[model samples]
Target: MKKTLLTFAVVLAIASASNAQTKIPPNIEKLLQKNTCLACHKVDVKLIGPAYKDVAKKKYKPEQIVELIKKPVPSNWPGYIPMAALPNVPADEALTIAKWITTLK
Candidate 1:
């Protein structure tokens, strides 16, 4: 019984830690999925693209982020491959995603 309780506690702790690490609002998550942004980005870890947290650290204005989404600047991220422009994304959607990204720690 004691071993079972300890295992449960450990599982609970890991679940809570995972939840705390990444919590995108449902609306933002919907937008990200719709935009296919999740293909290369994560809330806290680098995927094919830099993590949202790292982008947030740059402290870009929301509008700037929107522009970057439409027209990515390769020089700003030296090691990464140049991000292709996503001009097809609607302005409002891009702004919404950009604002959410800036809120990340």
Candidate 2:
């Protein structure tokens, strides 16, 4: 019975992880590419920027994430690799990206 339960748990974990692979919204995807945000960030894996999964875990309101993207939060990220302020990136685009990121699990 213990072995059976363990197998079931493993299967469940795999299923959940697979189901949580969120896609980038079309406009957000285009914005990321245009703004070069994709160079440092990915929808799943951690690159120079933390993964979208990590961002979603913060549970911050969508508005907060938008502000962070526009201004950056080096303290929250903490490192020699400080987040660059995306002053050139439009605020509306950042908010769209933020809303999409919140759907990541």
Candidate 3:
């Protein structure tokens, strides 16, 4: 019983550590807040849309990401609802966010 409990605790700790969220840089965090991107996206976890880390996994170039922000493609993410186009986001800010997203694991 004692060995089983110890093994369970060890597995739980490993899982928790593996799933820990990555810390967002302050500058990027501010931009995300200002653009309201956090309303749907998170660094490591999926919210309304896919997680930034998942987006990073897609290996999209920063330019492509910026375009996606301005004009979302629903077909790219079948299950999730189409993202609203954020044409109002300044070009530079969008690029900044895209570059940061590409840096995610």
TM-score (C-alpha, index-matched) for candidate 1: 0.81
> Which lDDT tens digits does candidate 2 get at residues 21-86?
567777778988998989999877889998888889988888998788778878887653888888
| Candidate-wise lDDT, in order | 0.91, 0.83, 0.94
Ranking by lDDT: 3, 1, 2
**Candidate 3, residue 17: how far the Cα is off, in Å:** 3.8
Candidate of highest TM-score: 3
TM-score of each: 0.81, 0.74, 0.89
For residue 52, what is the lDDT in candidate 3? 95
Best by lDDT: 3
lDDT of 2: 0.83
How does candidate 1 score on lDDT? Answer: 0.91
CA displacement after TM-score superposition, residue 79 of candidate 1 (Å): 1.4
lDDT, model 1, position 4: 100
In model 2, which range of ten residues has the least summed lDDT? 19-28
**Which RMSD values do the candidates have, in order?**
4.1, 3.4, 1.6
